[model samples]
Target: MTNIPEGKQMEAAIQNSFNEAKKLYEKHGIDVDDVLEQLSRIKISLHCWQGDDVRGFLNKGRELGGGIAVTGSYPGRASTPEQLRDDIDKAFELIPGRHKVNLHAIYADTDERVDLDELAPKHFENWVKWAKQKGYGLDFNPTCFSHEKASDGFTLSHPDAEVRQFWIDHCKASRKIGEYFGRELGQPCVTNIWIPDGYKDAPIDRLSPRVRLMEALDEIFSDPIDEAFNIDAVESKLFGIGSESYVVGSHEFYMGYALSRRKTVCFDSGHFHPTETISNKLSSWLLFGERLLLHVSRPVRWDSDHVVTMDDELLDIARELVRGKLLEKTHIGLDFFDGSINHVAAWVIGTRNTLKALLRAMLEPVDRLKEIELQGDYTSRLALVEEFKSYPFGAIWDYYCRNAGTPVREEWLAEVKRHEREVLCKRSQGEGSVV
Candidate 1:
């Protein structure tokens, strides 16, 4: 059983730690309470694919295509929407912040197999209702892969006009659904477009596919949707499983397109070369892009989509966002799926690590460092950085978790394991559920 502290004792301990940390931060001209409040308000959009391992309801548990793969045979995968939501809610209870949900078009709840071109917002009515009931925000994505039309490793940029048009219509429909979510939830929905349109081997006429993609995107965004209700975005990938040689929507392509079109640019952390880091690009993109959609993930040698951890790279990302004050200009979201362990545990761990990274960044003495830098005291700045590493940030974090009513530290794992025993194990028998 988890050693979660009792009600009154937990509250008192948290308060005592918070009080000491508050004084410590004030000595460095930082406001701990204000930082905590801001952190509480930041919503990390949780990816829906994590719960189900990217296997959507369409085609009845078919494998994922589109340069995506979820390896491992983790028990108790969510086969239905109800099960997915239950698992997601259970994970949220262990996380210490209010967050949003990011959904792909394939996750639409419907009785019939809705074709790509014919999909409508009504299909996701259940999602909107559930999100509203939970007081959560929603984001959307256009599913351009894992279908018959995209079997050739192409969708929006397919050579055949008919196939390309089908994907375009799907994207247009996605934007309309996103608008519906925004209007109903009273928050703008970010509808992102990412297609696995590339060639495995070397191909001639790469420019042609990109041109077709540009035209198709123009058609998808031709209709004006109010920005208040919905914002459109396009994503780019470096390369993937079958698309090793080239990806039509490369970073340069999307960056130029987003700049010219005044659209949000999605900077996926795992979508770049292994040596590259998206954190360094934050300040630069904020100068031109209206908004940035960040897909926070840990890439192991490639876009393997490992669960995020509080590593140096992740810490750098949080620090960049905090130092640049780009939180309001950025839409933070998770974009990884690890099926090697408990799916619920994966979600909780990734989300909590992200929150913890952000807290660490927020607790930094940014102003003092800046003042030292401006005074040309580089020596002091470097020394102060090393010194601040020993601050009582962990105590503050525990307090924050306590106030959020989540299990502090390792205590959350016990709850997840209990859930696995009582809930997940039962689904393994007498059903066509676990894949």
Candidate 2:
């Protein structure tokens, strides 16, 4: 049998490679050590929905509603809160650096069915405890869809007073829970509200629905929670599966609201048209908004919510953040779910790819590039940009994984498969207890 490296031998190998990589980066005026430290501080919030196919444990695995769909039927989907947390833990172990947990209102751990309007902080007590214990910051979302009240595809902008009030109460309650999360975790929780309120066919009274939406949002934000504990954000979608014709909260609507209300705005990667990228829009939005929340997801052609990859758009987004030094002003979170593979593996892949993009961006010689650009040395700038493609960035990334004590490269996949064989498979076979 071939001798496999482990223990001290593996550690020594990683250190040796990292040292060489550090020297290589120094030639380009890049501080590899400082870059690694900065990368460590960039916490990507992992979405909770990926572990359960967006099938919130609400109403006992009821079919998803409100234009949401998970296309694959991969086995080992977490059926309970405990199972989902277990899967998340496995994925987190594989990813490097400290991270945050993003939760939806439907993920509340309750014994009985809790109406959306009646949701409270108590519903999310367990999540707070888990987040505190794991040292993960908590972010929250109000479940504006997948309920009876939202069957008509309108929430927050519903025509009926009673229907609109139901969602408003739910949103208000969700903010309270978000505040509680912030207090417990000692970090401000981003309470984001996204609603699927539109029609499959074009509506004649589009303006009226938007008017109602503005009024409803006014009510939702009427009670101000201390900014120290919680911050509010509004997300807009282009068009969902059911509402392909008209979406109430289009990007224009929320952008206007954020500008007027002076609240943080959210830009979901999959929410825009395929040809339109958020990379160029960052600086523009930053000029107007104080902070922006990013939902890093992949949309094949539409808002399919596929798992994120290290594609050009993803890299550009990370580059924009690094080049503009916008990391601190942006809250990065993953928002994709692919149930066709191991859920833990999906989480690990998406989160790791996100970190990879950020690290690559940080490795760029931005100061030098900008200097050349300012001097009008377009030829040298182009030459330098092309030269950077061949740098030893992988060695530095391997060093980061080693320093973070996470499995380096292909090694993490083995660990995930082992868990699937030993744990997840048993759960699917009915040999393990969940919840």
lDDT of 2 by residue, 142-252 (tens): 998888889889989999999999999999998999899999899999999999989999889889999999999999999878888898999999999889999999999
lDDT of each: 0.90, 0.90
Model 2 TM-score on a 0 to 1 scale: 0.96
* TM-scores for every candidate against the unseen true structure: 0.96, 0.96
> Under the 3 Å rule for N, CA and C atoms, how many clashes does model 1 have?
0
Model 1, residue 35: C-alpha shift (Å): 0.4
lDDT of 2 at 362: 91
lDDT of 1 by residue, 128-190 (tens): 999999988999999898888999899988989998989998999999999999999999899
After the best TM-score superposition of candidate 1, give how far the Cα of residue 212 lies from its true spot, in angstroms. Answer: 0.5
